[model samples]
Target: MSQKSAPRPPKTSPDATRRSEKSRRAIYAAALELVGEVGYAKTTIEGIAARAGVGKQTIYRWWSAKADVLLEAFLDLGEQAAEQAAGPGAEYGIPDTGDLAADLKAVLRATVDELLDPRFEVPSRALAAEGVVNEELGREFVAKLLDPSLQLYVRRLRSAQDAGQVRPEVDPRIALELFVSPLAQRWLQHTGPISYAYTDTLVDYALYGLAPR
Candidate 1:
């Protein structure tokens, strides 16, 4: 017979756990607000801790660097946004409704709404502006935040291809840019207004050819 396994650690009390979660959320809020108010280069762990009303050591105990903390904070923000949009416990991913156009439009519309939200827009714009000048930081944050969302599109497109909606010859990665890049440009440049109807049109134009098909 095998030896008994080591005993499991005792669970944290509900009150203790609640306090920990509250502190963690406060940190995230403080980080987002600070980064938005002052660009990423200027934002610091000390400032975040002060804004969060916690000691510097409190933040250090959880995250090794400001970058790590910011990344997690953004990720938490995304999950919170997703939960608000798509009920609780909803995993952030594209909907695979089998109707390619409808599925694409649905996600894009949600994205348009997100881009318009000031809480997400301000800090993200700050980070994006900084990223344009700071290539290394840009790449790091893009890999952590943006690429995961892009990958969701890639997965959804691959599913469409498997279902025979998209041509097997077409590259899903490039195909997605047709709709995604346009919306991105508009948001970043203030070139055009963003709306559900606008995104719906993009999905239609992307899936169905621009020239008469």
Candidate 2:
């Protein structure tokens, strides 16, 4: 068997790290803002570079295409959202406080907050609307931006399964969507109002289901 590789060294200097962080933040903000203002069709690497006040070569040095830039920018948006919305030491992972209902409620509530934030909402809707008509971009977006969060639900549901809260035969992936998809649909389609009450009901409905449990 191949031996385990050695761990990589940590970032050494605070200044270098800060510079990297600043550049990354600027790029993400520029991408999101540009997409929001101009829509995805008009969004370009050059536009992001201009909005970010960075050289075009700098963006090219980091990402190959506009899609990559937007996707990574969305990912960075998620990071910033979590940081601002969640408490210190909290992360994107599912809460495992042992009360599955509470954890789900907390997460959904936070998601409701994020979906309402203009910083996240505008760009996301622009991209999502484009995805509705663009198959390749849709799949790519789902794979990178969406699947990671879905996996966290999988983990939480798996734990609930182990604890005899969720049924063993239930597919965690689909079960998670029973709640997730509804909210996403509501937000993306303007099908209904997204609120804490809405999400709280979603958690209850997903767990007990709509079959009068």
Candidate 3:
């Protein structure tokens, strides 16, 4: 049996894994850069492959369309941002320090920083603009990227409601919009300056209301 044992299958080396990871990152970077530079309408699999320095077949092997590549690229960008914001191996979610107001402010402030980051700002704006005009892409963008983040706020707000910090009658999802929407509008529309101070005030207003106590 020892002499007759079938040849063992070759195992993938660490170098192979590293090379694959490197190629994947290059692809993501190429996709974001191209979209930011030329808008989504003009970005193509062939173009992305060229920019990424990979063969067209490599892209086709991983993704069926350019849309899938761009969406995954955005998701990767978000994940990297989250890791940078929270630290390595950190789980993505709103923090619950039992102080709902403080937690909201902290998360929003991080969002403010992210929005202002050049690496994130340009590509995100480009994609968001495209989503506005493209119906199917818009739905997918909301479902995959936007809604997951929104759900985190919903869960945090629901916890606040349970603890009597937020009113029981309030809807957590809609209540999140009170503060979230204003910041989003300001950033997306360039209607106003975005800052930590601005987001903090928004949280105060949403939690305590504008009228005097």
Candidate 4:
């Protein structure tokens, strides 16, 4: 006589994957909103769990603490913005359209829109101000979020130099910063208002050399 075998459990499908993504987005949104409402020093893991409508265990299962969750949330926000700006699978890199001026302006224009969006701006300023005094977190923020995007600009600038769009003598690292850092400082420090005209001028000044040309 043959014995009946136990049935196998059903596997998760695309719908499950999508649901999980939705849950993750909710958790990130809750974390950002909470942090913005109450400074990071008071933002607690338990608070995030409550705000996210998940059990503490659920948050613990995914993140060690509020800091880890907030750090990754910001990183995910950047990737989402990049995907939206560049389109699906287009990469987060600066566009090498052969026209340096046009490409820089295009990227910077997207940046302007992102900066103006309250969802991005409020949380970012809270984090940035904290980073100004919190050295370790500041460095981590730079390494994880800022540096990667900056590197893409550097690589594109290097390629532009090879193609004769940029002068070969220009240091791609420093050269990329000419446009990037100005906008960063303005946004972070509120040194000036951001606009298309400002970033367009940055591109022109960076490419042409501000001294004489």
Which number leads on lDDT? 3
Task: Give the alpha carbon lDDT tens digit for every residue of 1-213 in model 4.
Answer: 978697664577989878767878888999899888887888888888798887788788778877789998998888888788778776676777789899889989889999998989888888888889999888988888788888878888888989998888888988888888899999988899999999999999888885874
lDDT of 2 by residue, 1-213 (tens): 978698665766999778767887899899999899989999999999988988999899779999999998898778867877676556668789989999999999989988998988999999998999999999999999999999999999999999999989999999998889999999999998999998899899888877864
Whole-model Cα lDDT of every candidate shown, in order: 0.92, 0.90, 0.93, 0.86
**C-alpha RMSD of each candidate structure in angstroms:** 3.3, 2.9, 5.7, 6.5
Summarize candidate 3's per-residue lDDT along 1-213 as a digit string, tens digits: 358567664577999878878989999999999999999999899999999999999899789999899999999999999999889889999999999989999999999999999999998888899888999998999999999999999999999989999989999889999999999999999999999999999999999999998
Model 4: worst 10 consecutive residues (lDDT sum): 2-11
Angstrom error of the Cα, residue 161, model 1: value is 0.9
Candidate 3 regions with alpha-carbon error over 4 angstroms: 1-11
Q: Which stretches of candidate 2 lie over 4 Å from their true place?
A: 1-20
What is the per-residue lDDT of model 1 for residues 1-47, given as tens digits with 9 covering 90 to 100? 97869866459999988888899999999999999999898999999
TM value for model 4 = 0.87
TM-score of 3: 0.93
How do all models score by TM-score?
Answer: 0.91, 0.88, 0.93, 0.87
TM-score ranking of the models: 3, 1, 2, 4
* TM-score of structure candidate 2: 0.88
